[model samples]
Target: MLSSYNNNKVIYSGTGRRKTSIARVKLIPGSGKLIINGLPGESYLQFSPNYLRISCAPLNILGLHKEYDIYVKTQGGGLTGQADAIRLGLAKALCSVNPENRITLKSEGLLRRDARIKERKKYGLRKARKAPQYSKR
Candidate 1:
């Protein structure tokens, strides 16, 4: 038997992928604060103001002005990769909160996963595509 209290507080989980990185997010309705793992808010290695700004954009668009703290655990990504992953996670979380907002968020393309990665360097090349000095003598 399920209790009524559990109904109001929904636990929504979502995953975001970018390049080789992956981010997993669990959203619960509460005060505004970002948590990664069991550590405090300041413990996450990829904390960035810009990331938070971009990730939280969906909340604002959905008219959820008040703070809704999020608990996220992300791995296999760099700082920028993690940020974009978080953004996707946040967007999915917003959708879970209310399905009606899907059209709005979808139109903005916030749900899309970025698939750009570093190009591997080719043999005999200085870089991914740059070639060594050519001699025609």
Candidate 2:
């Protein structure tokens, strides 16, 4: 849907963001391999099994988990954000393959980008909106 596609090109790609994490995803017809950056999906998401689940949820939702390979490069934010970004990216790439999937993806809430982000700490405040506790004299 982002253009730059051709009959010779067998890859569909999409960009996704969550919090501070940004993921670039490419979907290729292959044997369900998920490679992130330079690491295998599991190795890349070693902290928790949830990350792997999150990354593959979209494909699983559509029962296409074994039909395509997911290639992703993600940066910024924590692991959760990266996982979620990957999920969103995967959903988009799937959409490129079949626009009909959009409704199901949307119904499953995969295509929506999570927008929650950490608020910046202000110069005079202890944190984004928190201030030092006042002690009355």
- The TM-score leader among the candidates is 2
lDDT of 2 by residue, 37-99 (tens): 988999889957788889999999999999988889999988989999999988998898999
**Runs off by more than 4 Å, candidate 2:** 2-9
* lDDT of every model, 2 decimals: 0.73, 0.88
State, as a TM-score between 0 and 1, how close model 2 is to the true structure: 0.92
Instruction: Name the regions of candidate 1 deviating beyond 4 angstroms.
Output: 1-8, 39-47, 65-67
lDDT of 1 by residue, 1-137 (tens): 11123457867777877877677777777876777666544446455667666766777777673657777787886766776787788788778767887889899898887878889999999999999899999
Tell me, by lDDT, which candidate is best: 2
